[model samples]
Target: MHFAIVGAGFTGAVLANELAKAGHNVTVYEIRPHVAGNCYSERDEKTGILLHKYGPHIFHTDNEEVWNYVNQFTDFMPYVNRVKTTSQGNVYSLPINLLTINQYFGKTLSPKEANDFIKSLADGEIDEPQTFEEQAMKFVGKDLYEAFFKGYTLKQWGRSPKELPASILKRLPVRFNYDDNYFNHKYQGMPKNGYTPIVERLLDHANITLHLNTPFSSENKVSVDHVFYTGPIDAWFNYNAGRLGYRTLDFVREDHEGDYQGCAVMNYADEKVPYTRISEHKHFSPWEEQERTVIFKEYSRKCEEGDIPYYPIRLVNEKTMLNAYIGKAKKEKNVSFMGRLGTYRYLDMDVTIAEALDASRKTLDCVNKNKPIPVFFVNPL
Candidate 1:
């Protein structure tokens, strides 16, 4: 069978690889010149630093199967993202650990002491927390929320934390212990040769043909047995309902003589700081030594028509718009939606690969049984 895969990112690349391996012809159409979507990484010509073009992407997942699958493509170096955030001219460890708590308050606090202190500071009156601000106040109290989350959340999302959902703040941890690792996943690493090579290798197959700088529109649609769209769902339908909300990033590239931030990611939690975070690219690849370091000061804003969408702003209004698109997608024949943009969700790289693998397996199974392909392998909403 022949498959028309849209957007040569992880979703399309992974599915293309899977189907190609099964002796099916796959044609991948990538609107961007690059194959890896947001995870595109390349070495700097002058600095020799492996730069994450879009932003910093740390591959971390508890799913052993997904880890092993990515390992097949490229060698992954052991990397733990120990994030640091600056608030009110002070730097502190991320994930709100005991060390952070003690440092912020200027007191040596034990795990138990810190836990009790935070609970006491929490708003006990608000039994049921509703918004992001409420959830943060309930978990880490007013002080921590205002200092760390309030400004950062507002800058990142371009809205007040009170307007955001509680689920957003829930993803951020408030730890009593001193563990400062950003993610709790068992498998955490960055690709040795960078993310682009891994994705390029995934699409490199006898049965697969890739077309870069090719936009897959209704006018230029290909004749294939099935279509796997990794692009935005609303865009596929020509934005009939409305443009879903998304937060796009503008990276201000900088070169330094020595170490810049001394960490992979240094987040600016102060609203006074224009950019949200500054990521040192060389720190991402610690195994390779580069005297010249490169960094990106990331600024987030509302995604426009031609802007590259980074994070999905899945607020109430966006959800309504997404649901309408999903309804239209379900009615389409021989087409399936998967990945962050297609499903209209904020998904990690691991989750995207896992879903792509699952979608491919299900697709192949249905083909063998002469059953119709599913509209969506996973629920969008």
Candidate 2:
């Protein structure tokens, strides 16, 4: 079977690799000069630091299958994302742990004392949270919410917390203990050689052909057994409905003589700070040592026509548009939409890989049964 995959990112690359291994001819078209999509990482020629081209992507997931699968392509270095934040002229650890609670209040409270204190601060009136503001207030109360979340949320999403969904803040933890680890995952690490090499290795096969800096469209559609599209779902149909809302990021790069922030990520809780956080690239790979350091101050805004979409803003309007696109996609022939962009969701690397593997297995099953390939292996909505 012959397959044409659009966008040589994790989804496309994984699918291409899986299908190629099963004796299928795969052709990958990537508009960008490089692969790996938002997970793209490369070394800076001047500083000699391996910079995460987009931003810091800490590979953390409890899924054992994804953990083992990724290990096959590249060796992952042990890395844990410990984030720091600045609020009201004070530096604090993130996730609002015991240490942060103590530092913020200037009191040495035990875990039980801290928990009870937070409960006292919490808005006992509100039984259920309907918005991000309500959720935060109920969880950690006004002072902590305003200090840490309010300004940052406004800057990151370009919207008020009251207007956003409660689910956004639900993922954030308010720890009683002194654990500052950002994620609670069984497997957490970064690819030693970087993510680009992983995708390159995936596409590096006898049955797979790579096309760099190529824009794939309906015109580029060829006589193939199936098409696996990892590009924007709206763009695939030429935005017949409307563009889905997404937040794009602009990175301000800086080079310093020595250690900059002394951490991988530092979130600015104040709205006065233009950028959300300043990430020191060298700190991401603590195993490697370098004299100079590189950092990127990340600024978030509504995704423009040509800007690379970083995070999907799944607001009501965006979801409506997405559903329309999904409806159109379901009726399409010999095509399978997979990945974050295609599904119109913000997916971690592990979830993306797991879905791609599932899609590939399903595709092979369909071929064996002489059935038409599905429009989506997993529901987009």
Candidate 3:
């Protein structure tokens, strides 16, 4: 069977590779000229630093299969994403660990003392959380939530904590002990040559034909057995139902000598900062040598026309809009929705790749048996 895969990101690339390996012809249509989507990286001409074209993407995953699969394309360097936050003109370790708590309070707090202190701070009345703020307060109390999450959440989502769902807050951790590693994943690293080369190698197969700077038309389907759409669900149907909600990013680049923030990621957890975080590019690849460092001050806003979509903002209104699209999606015959935009959920690189692999396996099994493909590969709603 021949398949037409939309977008050359990990979703499409992985699907294309799988189908091609199964003796099926696969054609990938990428609107962007490059592969890897947001994780695309290449050597910068100005300073010879490998720039994360969209932003910084540090590959971290617990799944051994995913770790091994990614390693097939390029060698990976061991790296831990040690993140810090700048709030009220001071720097503190992220995840609200014991070290952060001690530093913020300016007291040498023991594990037992810190635990009891936090318990004292928490509001016991709100047993179940309905919103992001409530969930955060329940776990870490008000002071920490206000200092770290509240302002950043407001800036990132463009909504108050009461307006946002509790699930968003659950993604972030609140540690009782002092462990500053941002991700709790067992395996965390980066590609030796960068993400683009790895993605390029994934799509490199005899049966795979890539068409860059090309967009697929829903009205005119390519001559293939099935289509796997990694693009926005609303865009595929020409926004007939309604436009799906998305939060886009704007990167303000600044050049600095020697070092910028000492850490790779520094979150500005105050509304006064304007930008949510500043990602120092030099810190991303510690293996390289460069005197000057480039930092991208990230600003999140409501996705606009001709803007690169970064995060998905699935507020209540957006959920209603997404449900309508999913309804239409179920009735579709050939195409299947996969990945973050397709499912209308924010997925990290690990989750994204895991879903893609699962989707590919199920899709291939159905195709081989001449069975109907499922509407949603991984359910978001």
Candidate 4:
């Protein structure tokens, strides 16, 4: 069977590779001139540093199978995502660890006592959290939430925490211990060369062809036996129910001599600061050394027409629009929508690959047994 993958992100590239390996021809269509989508990385000529074209993406997951799968393409270096934050002109550690708690309160309390004190700070009257603000207040109290999450969340989503759903805030960790690791996944590392090479590896097969700067639509969907669309689901149906809500990021690049920010990521917790976070590219790959460094002050805002959508603002209205798109997708024929934009859910790199692998495996099985393909691989939609 021949497959046309709509976007060359991890979901499309991995599935393309998997299906191609199983005796199928695949062509990946990407509007962007490059592959790997948001995770694309390239070398900076002046500083010779690998720049994360979109933002920093730390590969962290507990799944050994995922770790080995990526390792087959490129060697990963030990990279710990130790994030720092500045709130109200005060600098502190992230994930609300012991150091942050002690520094914020101007006291050196033990981990256990710190945990208890935080529990004390929480509003006891609030039994159930219905919004992001409520969830933050319940978990870490008002002070921490205000200092760390409130302004950032507002800037990231372009909405007050009260207007957002509780599930959005649940992704953040409120640790009572000294563990300051941004992600709790057992396997954490970064691609030694960059994510671009890993993606290049996935598309290096002879049977696979890549068509960059291609805007795919339903008109071109007839050649392939099945379709794996990683583009926006609403766009697939020509926005019949209007566009979904998404937040796009604008990166303000600044070049500096020596180390900048002293860490990989620095969250600007104050509302006055326009950008939510500033990422120092050099710190991501510690093994490399360069006198000059570069940083991207990330400004999040509502995605305008023709803007690169970074994160989806899945508010009530957005969800309603998404459901309408999903309904249209259900009625469609010979196309399987997968990945974040396809399913209208926020997915990390690991989960996207896992789902794509499963999808490819099932697709292969169906062809062998002469069965029809599915509309979706994962059922989060």
The residue pairs that clash in candidate 1, if any, are none
The estimated TM-scores of all candidates read: 0.98, 0.98, 0.97, 0.98
Query: Taking the tens digit of each residue's C-alpha lDDT, what string does model 4 give over 134-196?
Result: 988987898988999999888989889998989887755777778889888999999999999
Task: For candidate 4, report its TM-score.
Answer: 0.98
Error (Å) of candidate 3 at residue 37 is 0.9
**Pairs of residues at least 3 apart in sequence or in different chains that clash in candidate 2:** none
- lDDT (C-alpha, whole model) for all candidates: 0.91, 0.92, 0.86, 0.89
Give the 10-residue window scoring lowest on summed lDDT in candidate 2: 217-226
- The residue-by-residue lDDT of candidate 2 on 111-187, one tens digit each, is 99999999999999988898999999988999999999999999999999999989887655889899999998999
Candidate 2, residue 370: the lDDT equals 95
Q: Tens digits of per-residue lDDT for model 1 on 239-337?
A: 989899999999998888899889999999999999999999899999988888888999999999899998898989999988899889989988888
Which prediction has more favorable lDDT, 1 or 4? 1
Model 1 residue 177 CA deviation in Å: 1.9
Off by over 4 Å in 1: 219-222
